[model samples]
Target: MHILQPRHIRLKKEEAEELLKRLNISVSQLPKIFITDTALPEGCQKGDVVRMERKYEDKIYPYYRVVVGSLNEKKNG
Candidate 1:
């Protein structure tokens, strides 16, 4: 799954694309955010935006964020 960071949140690519379709907007139109977590799931890469889904009670929410590299590892050496 692709990862994304947008406005203090992280999401997967599939989720992001779905959100774009639902919201009727492109990814560039969304707010800019960074992935602050270091222990992201495996295969998450730098510069990749991830889309995710959240459920609260009976309600579901979708969001996206940009993967600005890992806080624990250095992408550039």
Candidate 2:
């Protein structure tokens, strides 16, 4: 699992699409992070950058960083 940094970016669907096209990548390529709530706020859609953190536990492991993109639909309920 990856996390998003500088987590909040506001952009419309078209803008996000254009960015993806320009970057030659899809949402899956980016990290998966989302707002605290399961559902995005009104007027806010997917393809948004969100801040997140991940923890690793191992004797020889080092800290890692991540960036989240594209909000997923609520799973339960």
Candidate 3:
């Protein structure tokens, strides 16, 4: 992980559930991060939630994203 890159962690099943309840939002509602993203921790799969910790002005802010498969763009000829 690069020094400037924020820390990314995959939440456990129970933790994810609690977070959803606390936020009153479903997993699908969270922002999406591709499964191939280098910042994402290993062992992540579809429907998994990743928590990103970003620091600014000496304060840490948590960002959440749901793991999703890569999108394949089809060219219409």
Candidate 4:
């Protein structure tokens, strides 16, 4: 991990649902994060949601991304 990069966190099912509720969107509508992303926490699986707290210029931004298998991974069944 980069010195300045925040850790990528996996969310529990409840937390993931809460995040989706806050955004008024379903997990399928969320952005994708490649499974190979270095920040991804170990043991994370496809279709999981990750929370990344990015820090820049002393500001911390919260970002939620859905883990996907590949660049063209499908979001819906």
Candidate 5:
């Protein structure tokens, strides 16, 4: 949402599945992102996958993260 921040998009269930298959990695193997992260899109919850689009040089690269509950919440809930 910021000028310098990468765009984050929450992937649907089917898309997430396809991505995992294409990458040959499970959701747990992907990087983790907290649900409380400011850049995460609304409605994101635990087990959701987010795609981040970052521009470098003349091309854009895609990065993925699996949403997890906040540490604090994990401890309390």
Candidate 6:
């Protein structure tokens, strides 16, 4: 049986805009996370935006990350 997992989802266009407004950062400024993560839902693609929700204290917090290519595929400086 599956035990626990982090909440992962793609934001709608409007939601993405709201997040950017709240964070004061652009999409490129957001950090990258793995789309291949087992805790994530399938069908995620590179460059897709992902929102991760975590519960802490008495409230749930949302974090945003972008899907990126594997380490082996990263461009070298």
Top candidate on lDDT is 5
lDDT of 6 by residue, 1-77 (tens): 15345588887768888888988988889988866566656777877778887777668787888887766676562
Model 1 regions more than 4 Å off: 1-39, 70-77
Tally clashes: model 4: 0
- After superposition, which runs of candidate 4 have C-alpha atoms over 4 Å from their true positions? 71-77
lDDT digits (tens) for residues 5-77 of candidate 2: 2233355557667767977978677555354444333344344633223334533322211233334435532
Clashes of 5: 0
Give per-residue CA lDDT, model 5, range 1-77, as digits (tens): 78789999999999999999999999999999998999999899999999999999889999999999999997998
The lDDT per prediction is 0.57, 0.44, 0.90, 0.87, 0.95, 0.77
Report the lDDT tens digits of candidate 1 across residue range 1-77: 33433223445667667777988987676653445564445566665666556656677576665566344545553
Q: What TM-score against the true fold does each predicted structure earn?
A: 0.44, 0.41, 0.90, 0.81, 0.93, 0.72
By how many angstroms RMSD does model 2 differ from the true structure?
9.2
- How do these models rank on lDDT, best leading? 5, 3, 4, 6, 1, 2
Model 6 residue 56 lDDT score: 75
Compute the lDDT of residue 47 as modeled in candidate 6: 72
Sorted on TM-score, highest at the top, how do the candidates line up? 5, 3, 4, 6, 1, 2
| Cα lDDT tens digits for candidate 4, 1-77 | 88878868899999999888988999999899889787799999988999899888888888888988965555543
Task: Report the lDDT tens digits of candidate 3 across residue range 1-77.
Answer: 99899999999999999999999999889999988788899899988999999999899999999998876522332
Candidate 4's TM-score: 0.81
Please list all clashing residue pairs in model 3, or write none if there are none: none
